[model samples]
Target: MNCSRVNLKNNTLYKIALGLVVAVSISACTTEPTPPVETNELPCRVAGYFKSQDRVGGFYRCVWNASINRWIQYPYDCPRGLEFSEQLQACVKP
Candidate 1:
């Protein structure tokens, strides 16, 4: 086997590994999620779904994190042309 060819193959593998490492690290880190209310607060004391107090067609979910022993709120939005129906507790066309 030619030494130069072997060196080039090793270099290509090294670059590929480095790229994968960077992609994984970036994906592992979470950015701050969007806030749902003017005060940027959610009463996550109870774990379940909650309506967004500010925006129309918006909602959020309160999930229990056993590792932290607390509730975390994740904001979501209904699909375009739909709104969250608090009465029905689901998204509906308004």
Candidate 2:
């Protein structure tokens, strides 16, 4: 009789431990994943004072010139068949 009681208690304890482990696993799988962070850096470009051109042959953009402590704009001329790419910071074929 005592042996039978001990077996029953052992089975009950095993079932309870199994139930706890399953519950923990399910909760872990259901958690939400972390989101990606955003940044202000431009793609295919470096962070510094520089110039870039637009599709038209006339428009241009210049960054702050630390040496002179001011912003300066320069006239940039793209090739007849190509335009300036701000992302690339150079003239590229359209």
Candidate 3:
């Protein structure tokens, strides 16, 4: 019919601990942050495509002959696929 002071203290501690555990568990269940969405605004620089650092002749951005250009089929995507060779200053096929 009566509760002891110690019992009240233990109940409060247990509630606090349970609340913290629930918070931590919910946070842990959070989804990984989605990668920033790629947008058309992102510069389609060829060097951006070649992330490799060790290779000397890694893929470079360059424009290809309109006839041979794969993007030619998708003219809307033009320039997006245009690769540039900084050394050559000319468009090169990616």
Which candidate comes out best when scored by lDDT?
A: 1
What is the per-residue lDDT of model 3 for residues 1-94, given as tens digits with 9 covering 90 to 100? 4578889989999999999999999999998633332233323333233221333333323222358543211011214455546555555667
**Candidate 2 residues 1-94, lDDT tens each?**
6998999999999999999999999998895533322322232132332333233643344455579765444454677877666577777787
Judged by whole-model lDDT over C-alpha atoms, candidate 3 comes out at: 0.46
Candidate 2: segments with Cα more than 4 A from true spot: 1-55, 58-68
Better of 1 and 3 by TM-score: 1
Kindly report which residue stretches of model 1 are placed more than 4 angstroms away from their true locations once superposed. 1-39
Give RMSD to native, each candidate: 6.0, 17.2, 15.4
Give the winner by lDDT: 1 or 2.
Answer: 1
Candidate 2 residue pairs in backbone clash: none
In angstroms, how far off is 11's CA in candidate 2? Answer: 97
Window of ten residues with lowest summed lDDT in model 3: 69-78
lDDT of each: 0.79, 0.56, 0.46
lDDT per residue (tens digit) for residues 1-94 in model 1: 6999999999999999999999999989967876543336557787666677876778887877799876777788899888887678898999
lDDT of 3 at 11: 96
> In terms of TM-score, how similar is model 1 to the real structure?
0.51
Give the 10-residue window scoring lowest on summed lDDT in candidate 1.
33-42
TM-score, every prediction:
0.51, 0.33, 0.33
